[model samples]
Target: MRLRRTVLPSPDLLDIALAFGSFGLFTLPVLIRGSGHSPTAAIVVLGLAATVPLSVRRRAPVPVLATVSLVLVGAALADVGFTVFHSNAGPALGIAVLTVADRLPRAVSLRASVAAVGLVTVAEVTAMQVHPATGQNAIQLVLAVPAWLVGYAFHTRRQAERRLRSETQERAREAERRVRAEERVRVSADVHDIVSHTLSMIAVRSGVARMVLEQRPEEALAALSAIETASRGALDELRAVLQSLRDAPGDPLRTAGALAAGPAVERPTLAHLRSLVGNLRDDGYPITLALSEKAGAPPPVEESAYRVVQEALTNVVRHAGRVATSVEVAGDPEGLSISVLNAAPAGGSPGAGPGSGHGLTGMRDRVALYEGTVAAGPCPDGGYAVRVHFPARPVNRTAPADRAEGKRRG
Candidate 1:
C-alpha cells in the first residue's frame, strides 16, 4: 500500500535503480570470485519481490501488505539484502496508513501501525542477530520505521487542508447568494414606496384639476403644472430606486425604507374618492362610486381602498379607452373589498398589453403593503377586473383635517 501511494514517476524509476543497486551488491561476490560464485538468481528473485506488490497496493491494501511482508521474510531467510525487497515496503505501509486513516476502524489503524513498527523492529533485530559479525549498529538499521511515520504525517496534513479549503469556498458562495437575495428585497420595497406614493399624488392632482377647470381656469392650469412637477419627481425617484435595486445587497445591515419624505402631509381618504372620480368622468369616461362602510376609523385602510379604486379606473380609461369606469368599495370592522371593472379598451393599452406592464404589478404591491391582496385579470364577461381586499382597522376619519390639508397640488 505504501509503495503504490508513493509510486510517483520520478521516484518509482529509482526502484529500477534499487534493483540494479541490489544486483551490483550481489555481483560483488562474483567479482571477488572472478569466475566462481554467481548470485544473479538470488538478486533476480529479490528484485521481483521488491516491485511486484506495488501494482495492486491501492486496490487491495491488506493483500499487498501481506505479499510484501511474505517477500521480506523470504529475502531475510535466504540471507539476502533486505533493501532489495524494501522497494515495495514503503508504499504498502503508506496505503495501510491511508486505509487506517479512512475506511478501516480507528482501533484497527492503531493496531496496524503498532504491528508495523513492531515488525520493522523484529526485521532489523534479526538482520543484526543473523549477521552480528558484520558489526552494523541497530540504530542505523531501525531508521525505516521513522521514515514511514513521517510520510504518514504528511498525507494526513494534506487531506486536512483540502477539506478546509473546500468548506471555506462553499461558505463564501452561500454568503454571496444571501446578499443578492437581500438586495432584491430592498430594491422592491423602494420601488413600491416611490411608485405608489407618486401615483397617488397624480390621481389627487388630477381631481384638483377637474374641480377648478370650470370655476378657476387659471388655478386648473396651476394644478396641471404641479401635476407635471409631481410626475417628474416620480420619474427621477424611480431612476434612483431602480439603481439601488441593481446594487449588491446590504452587507453589514439591511437597507431601511425610503428615506423620510421630510415633514409628511395627511394621506388621502374616501372623501377624496369623489374628486378622483369626478376628474376622470369630466375628462371623458363616466365614473361612479359606491361603498359599504360609512364609518371613518381606518385612515391607511381608506387610503388603500381609494387607491385601489383609483388604479383600477385609471387602467380602465387607459385600456378600455372611453369605456365607463365604475368602482365598488365595501368595508366592515373585519375587512374591506374594492373592485373596479371596465370594458375592453377601444384600442388603447391598460398601461399594459403593450408598452409596459409594471403598472398593475405596482398596484398589487401597494395593496399588499396594507396586508391586502389584489387580483387583476381579464373579466370573464369582457374587459379587465381589478379586485383588492384590506384587513380592517378601527374606522378613523380625519377628513375635516385631511381636507384642510388636502393637496391642492392636484
Candidate 2:
C-alpha cells in the first residue's frame, strides 16, 4: 500500500536553518569584535566549510562528519583559535555525529566516531603541542562519545516501537481469521438443521401422495397440499438464513447489533411443541409427549428444546418405522430437561438411514450452544433413548402458579 505523506515541516528546511544558525553563531562574534579580532581569509573559509556541510547532514551524515572534521583541523593548523573562530565547529560537529549514529548501523557509527576523535586529537596535539593524554584530548573524547551514545538510544527506541506495532497487527489478523472460521461453522449448522428436517418430511409426504393418487383422490390431494406447505415454509426459512448472510460486514447497514439481531422470522419455541406433536401424530408416528405444567425457559433455551424434540421425532419416523416413542420435558427456574425414548427398529438396527448421520451431530451442536448434553443409546429393555439437560431461569416466563391463580380469578 502506498502511504501518503502528511503535511509537516520539511527536513530540508530544518537542516538549512541549522546550517545558517551555526554560521551566524560563530561569525557574528568576529564581526562584533571589528578589526581588533579580524579573521583571516583562510579562517573565514574554514568556518564556512564547517557550517555549510551541516545542511546535508541527514542525507550523508558520515560524509558531513568527515568534512567538518577536516575544517576543524585546517582551522587549528592555520592559527584559528578562540579569538578568530571561537570553537564554532564543536556544536556543529556534535549535531552531525548524532545524526550519523541515529541513522546508521551501530558498528558503522562507532567506527566514524573513533575516526573523528582520532583526527581532532591529532590536530589539537600538532597545533598546541599538547601531550597525548592532556585535557584537550579528554574534552574532545567527552563531547563526541556522548552524542553517539544518545543517538543510539533513540535508534533502539524506534526499533522497539516498530516491532511492537507489527506484533499487535499480526495478533489482530489471527483473531479475525478464527472468528470467520467459527462463523462458517455456525452458518453450516443452521442450514443443516433447517434444510434436513424440512426436506425429510417433504420426501415422505411426496411418497404418500404418489401411492394414494390412484386409489383415493382426496387423500392424494391432502398429501400434495402438505408438500406445498412444507416447501413454502422451507423457502421462508432459507430466505431468513440468506438475509443473515447479507447482514455481515461491508454492508452499509451493518450496525453494532446487526449480527445478534439476525432475521425477523419467528423462532420456534416450546409453545409450538403441541402443534409439532399433533402434526407427527397426523403422519401416523406413534409418539407421545409429556410436558411439565410450569416449564419456563429463556427464548434461546426454548428454541433449542424445540429443535431437539424435532430432531428426535424425525429420527423415530425415519429409522424406527412406526415404533412407539415418548418425549418428556420438565423445567423450573434452575434448568430444563428433555428425554425421548423409542423402541428399536423392527430389524433391530439402531442407527439406520439418516439416524447415524449429521442429524445427531446437528442436534448435539444446537444443544451444546445452550451448554446442554445429549445421551443416545439402546435401552436395556430393547429401545433407544436420547436425553438432554441445560440450565435456565424462569424469571422471564409465566409459571404454573401464576396461570392457576389467573384461572381462579377469571
Candidate 3:
C-alpha cells in the first residue's frame, strides 16, 4: 500500500488563516485578563473589522488596506487603540501593500503605497500622541517599504518572463508560415512541370497522327498510342501529388502527408531519362542523352536533373524545328551537372512553344534551394543550351529525407 503525499494549502489560504489567528490571539488575551474571557461588543467589533478585510487582500488590496486602517483609527477614538493594533492587524496591512506593489504598474503602485502609508501613520500618531520618529512607529514604517520593494522585484521578473514567452510563440508562428508558403510554391511548380511537359508531348503527337491518318495509317496508329501513354502517366503522377495534400494538411514532417494514402507511385529519377528520351524520339525529335557513369546521387539532384531534361526536350519539340539535341549529365561528390544543347534554330526562328515563362523560373527557384545554379542561352556556335549544377546535397539548408515530398509540401 502506497501513501499519498499530503498537499499543502496555497499561500493565499495560509495568509487568510494567519490574519484571523492573529486577531483571535490579541483579543483572547485581553478578554481573559480584563473581562474574564467575555469581551464587550466594541472590542469584538474592532477585532472583526481588522481581520475580515484581509480575506480579500489580494483581489482588493487598496480597499482592504483602507478599511483596516480606518477601523484601527476608530478603535483608537473609542480608547481601545492600544489593543486594537496588537491583534497583528499591521502584518495584514503589510501583506496588502505588497500585493498592491506586485500587481499594479510602478507609477500607480507608488501613489497607492504613499496613500496607504500616510493613512496608517496618521492613525497611529493620533492614537499614541507621539512624534513621527521612534519605537513601534519607526519599525512599522521601515518594514512596509522593504515588503513593497520585494513585491516590485517579483513583479519585474514576472513581466520579463511573460514578454519572453510571447516572443517565442511569435517566432514559432512565423516559421510555420514560412514553411507553408514554401510548400505551396513547390506544389504549384510540380503541377506546372508535370502537366506542361506531358500535355505538350501529347499535343504534338496527336497532330502528327492526324496529318498521317490517310497516307500512313500504321504510323498514325503508333503516334496515337504514344499520346495515350503520356496522358495516362501524367494523370497518375498528378493524382499521387494531390492525394498527399488532401490526406494531412498540418503534418510538419517533410513526407508527412505525401503518399500516405496513395498507391506506391515511383518518383521520376535519372534512370527514367531513357524512357523520357525514347518517347520524344518516337515523336520525331533528333535527341541524344549522355549520362555519367556515376551510379547514384542525392534525390533532390536526381529529380531536378530529370525535370530539366524533360522541359528542355519539350521546348525542342515545340520550337527547335528538327534541330539535333543532346543531354549531358555528370557529377562527383561535390555536385551534379547537366546541360541540354540544341542545334541553332532553323530559318532564324527560336523554338517557339506554348509555354508559361514559369518553367524556367521554377527550375531556377528549385536549383537555388540547393545552392545550385542554372544558365540558359544561345551558345557561341549558334545553338541553344540549358545548363544546371546542383550541390550533391543541400547546403545552408537541412536536406529532406524524400526529395519527391517537395512535389506535394516542399
Report per-prediction Cα RMSD to one decimal. 15.8, 9.2, 5.3
Quantify all predictions' global Cα lDDT against the true fold.
0.55, 0.71, 0.71
Please identify which of the two predictions, 1 or 3, would achieve the higher TM-score against the true structure: 3
- Writing each residue's lDDT as its tens digit, candidate 3 over 129-213 gives 5422212232445657988898789889999999999999999899767656655655676687888888778778888899999
lDDT of 2 by residue, 1-410 (tens): 99999998799989989987876776656655662332556546766788889999989999999998887776565555422333333576778788888888899998997898689767866766533222233355567788888889987888889899999999989866754554454456667766766777777788888998999989989988988887877777666555555543455675444455554566568888898888777777788889998876765567668878887777777677678889999986668899999986776643346455687787777666556688887799777799988776333322222233345457
Residue 384's lDDT in candidate 2: 77
Q: How does residue 405 of candidate 1 score in lDDT?
A: 28
Best to worst by TM-score, what's the order?
Answer: 3, 2, 1
For candidate 3, list the clashing residue pairs, or say none. 319-351
Worst 10 residues of 3 by lDDT: 130-139
Say which candidate scores most in TM-score.
3
Candidates in order, TM-scores: namely 0.42, 0.70, 0.77
lDDT of 1: 0.55
How do the residues 172-229 of candidate 1 rate in per-residue lDDT, one tens digit apiece? Answer: 8986675455445434644554565456556656776999899999878977887797
**Counted clashes in each candidate structure:** 22, 0, 1
Q: For model 1, where is the 10-residue window of minimal lDDT?
A: 396-405
lDDT of 1 at 408: 29
